[model samples]
Target: MEADLEHYLEPGVGLLQDNASGCAWKNAAGKKISCAARETEALVSDLMVDQPLLWLLVSFSVGILLGKRLFRGN
Candidate 1:
């Protein structure tokens, strides 16, 4: 019985060994765990939120530029 179980499990064992080096596992929701992009986005968002005037000016300028480009094709 034990030998039969080991034999049956050998393929799974080999697959796990082959994929052991990298991030081959998923979370409970089937998503690969990662934080670098999230961290950078959060940091930039926080900076934007903290600088209200700068954020507003930047957004206004971008909006104007986009509007002009769309309307005037320039």
Candidate 2:
């Protein structure tokens, strides 16, 4: 039974062994963080690329706010 289990899990065992020295937990965490960062960056870039008008509106609103504050002395 044990031998059969080992045989069945041979590929998994080999994969674990291969990653043992590198520490799979740290590698997995790093990969996840890297993937999340890449996805976030891609999403932001896509938004900028697809919605220039939206960005323009945001910048215009900010400019208005700043202008109001700066010219409020009058």
Candidate 3:
């Protein structure tokens, strides 16, 4: 499924090779940090768990309002 999505999303771009294996951990300087994929997924899960629905709604509303104001010139 991921292969199909990648093909449609990046038509000109090359597909992700099946030879790919483990994930690389990059640091602030783009250096390998020795982090694992499981650790990254856990961190992302923790962040999503902490975020509130109201915050997302407010952010989306503000983005749309600002975009309209900027483009509509009023």
Best by TM-score: 2
**Which rank order by TM-score, best down to worst?**
2, 1, 3
**Model 1: per-residue Cα lDDT over 9-48, one tens digit each:** 7566867665785543444324423566677889899988
Which tens-of-lDDT digit does each residue in 1-74 have in candidate 3? 87667756655344334424423442332432334666788877876788767568888999999999889954
Instruction: Give the lDDT of residue 65 in candidate 2.
Output: 100
lDDT of 2 at 52: 96
Against the true structure, what is every candidate's RMSD? 6.2, 8.2, 16.0
Query: Using lDDT as the measure, which candidate wins?
Result: 2
User: Model 1, which residues run further than 4 Å from truth?
Assistant: 1-33
For every model shown, what is its TM-score relative to the native structure?
Answer: 0.46, 0.55, 0.29
Residue pairs with backbone atoms closer than 3 Å in model 2 (clashes): none
Give the per-residue lDDT of model 2 (tens digit) for 1-74.
Answer: 66666776757786776568788688999999999999999999998999999999999999999999999985
- Local distance difference test values of all predictions, in order: 0.73, 0.89, 0.64
